[model samples]
Target: MDSMQNAPSTEDTQRTSQPAPVLALLPETGVSYIRHAWQDMLSGMKLARLGATLGWLDIKLRYRGSILGPFWLTASTAVMVAAMGVLYAYLMNMDVHKYLPFLTFSLVLWGFASGTLQDGCTTFTSASGLIHSARMPYSLHVLRATVRNLLTVAHNIPVVVVVFLWFAVVPAWSWTMPAACALWVFDSFMATFLLGILGTRFRDVPPIVASTLQILFFVTPILWAPELMKTGQDWLLLDPFFPLMEILRTPFTGDIVNAAIWPAALGWSAVLTVVTFALFARMRARLAYWV
Candidate 1:
């Protein structure tokens, strides 16, 4: 009777045997998201060699059976440049010798910029199979798309060189040229990352981007000279593509780049990079799910 009285009650034993409460699943904070994004970007960059190889293979497979391979793009661009250069020069009443070089530089650079963005839309979606099958940094796919477009730009260099020789236009090399090119490259990566995320989330994004690019091409000073805009010459500064193209084209055409262009280019690049990184940080965790 004494032992039974001293023994613990059933309620007390149950209370003591129960497990401790677990903490709830908390959401990631802004700081943690940014940290993860930074880590992902760094990891992706380290795998650039794999990205480059895949990009090269993409080109090879695209022209597998063709004898001319990627040079077909070069030939077509050369032919288009020849035909359009002569026709537009006459139509605009501009001197062909002066106009062709500008047109060549503009078209080649525009192609690189536009192609990279367009391909950026498919950066993640196109690799959905690989993305699901293997775990890798999303930025690697971004680099792959950028590198592919870059290779196309490389193939088109011969066309630019031939035009330069035929017209005897001497490029005025400057420190600004390399600086502008580097900025352009950096901007491409930022744009690609942003576009890749949006594209993976929305299927309509690719068509929308393509359509917008088509409209921008005509409005941009690609086929005509900026000097043709008599009244709104200053408003050209409002055009996003203008500063980017001018900083690059000016150095190649032996023309003086406006002092204001560098600031504008840098400004645009900074804004793009910041916005892209922020959005990327916010969405990085959801990318695999979206893809």
Candidate 2:
């Protein structure tokens, strides 16, 4: 009775003057969770530091046991680039130096782009150990595979350095590289966000994506030059791989990228990202059962 009588206290009366917590009634937590599960998709989403760090760890772990550890990645990349560069570059009648950077960057970018999808098909199922037992975010699993591939790219970096040195051509020298890398990083995460959700649903998706990326590896200017094709100016600018890599290559080679690629590359990345996020948002609730 005494406590009830004192319920309306002087301190409480003073606190009542403060503002209440802001909650958007239209956007509830459930909707937010779904949104959070897939955010960076459509056009422009913030780069996820968490996703990137997780990718780096995956790389360290993948090559942890060797005497050279990750250097093995360096060595292996060198050999593949050299061998392929010699045979393919010669046949195309292009100078080895001119062709080398293109190939190295091609393979490395492919590593980043393909890494996410290749592993994503198994993102949920592979993490069955964690999926069922642990309560970690699903993004962490995607991080594992993407990071592992990034390590592959990291290993490939020195090869790029050596190629530039050997060719003695500063294909790109100034601000372009950072911009390209920035673009690559963003697109990579976008790829991860969407692929992570899709990978969980379709068991056969991984192999299918792997095979497709293999075909694209040949067609997408990795082993060959886009200019080598008969397709005209529009195709070169519009090639699926060119815009993405040119962003990187221009910076590396110090060439100005066509103004059109700015929107074309980023626009597609954004569109794909948004579509993936929307699908994931709609379907995330069912992931547990599907996995």
Candidate 3:
């Protein structure tokens, strides 16, 4: 009778049979996203050799069947600089020796800066075939675009050299020139990273980027000397591009760059880096789907 009483526990058996709750998986936090983004960039940088090779191939394919190949870039740039330099010097009543050197520096650097950003907008979109067909870090495409533009800039360097020699102008070559060049390269990567994501997601971005660059080219001191601006001269310091151009141009032209401009340029670079990195982190995961 005691054994039968102990076995009469259906309620206890039913309670024990119930399943325990499963813990829900947590969503990814911002820190994790940033970490992953950093990994992606590092992985891409590790593939720099591949990126550079592909970039070189791009140059070759672009000018295939041409006699001068990449040297065509140097020749065309020289012709344009010569024509613009003569016309602008006469129009502005500035000495050709001084004006031509300044113009050469301005145009070459501006071409690099503008080309980087403009190409940045097509970084991922142009590589859609590779992205879909292969498994690689999205940043590799960004590096590829940056490398291509850098190669283009290298081809244009001869133009700068010829202009300098023609005018008998010796470069002041400062430590800051290397620093500025490094900054330009770093900024190019950041820009390509940010714009690549946006460009992949939005089809209209490239046109808008191109149009904006065109407008900036006119307002920037590429065609005219900053010293000519008597009014709102202080506002030129506020122009983000002016400081960048000044820091780079001054070292080559032997002109004095205001000490204040260095801080401004660094500040702008920091702002661009931080903002682009954050966006890249947030968008990194979505890139594959978007592309």
- All candidates: TM-score: 0.90, 0.77, 0.89
Model 1: ten consecutive residues of lowest lDDT: 232-241
All candidates' lDDT scores?
Answer: 0.89, 0.70, 0.87
Model 1, C-alpha of 111: deviation from truth (Å): 1.4
lDDT tens readout by residue for model 2, 1-291: 999997988888889978998976564366775666645232122334655676676666766786898787678888888888888888999977778877887776776677656766666676677677856666566555565666666767888888778777576466666776777766665577566667777766778888988887776667786667675757665456668876776667545677887777877777877787677667766777777
Best by TM-score: 1
Task: Give the per-residue lDDT of model 3 (tens digit) for 229-280.
Answer: 8888767777778999998898789888887889989998899899988988
Error of 1 at 19 (Å): 8.0
**Backbone clash count, each prediction separately:** 0, 13, 0
Candidate 2 regions exceeding 4 Å error are 1-57, 236-239
Misplaced by over 4 Å in model 1 are 1-25
The best candidate by lDDT is 1
Off by over 4 Å in 3: 1-26
Model 3 RMSD in angstroms: 6.2
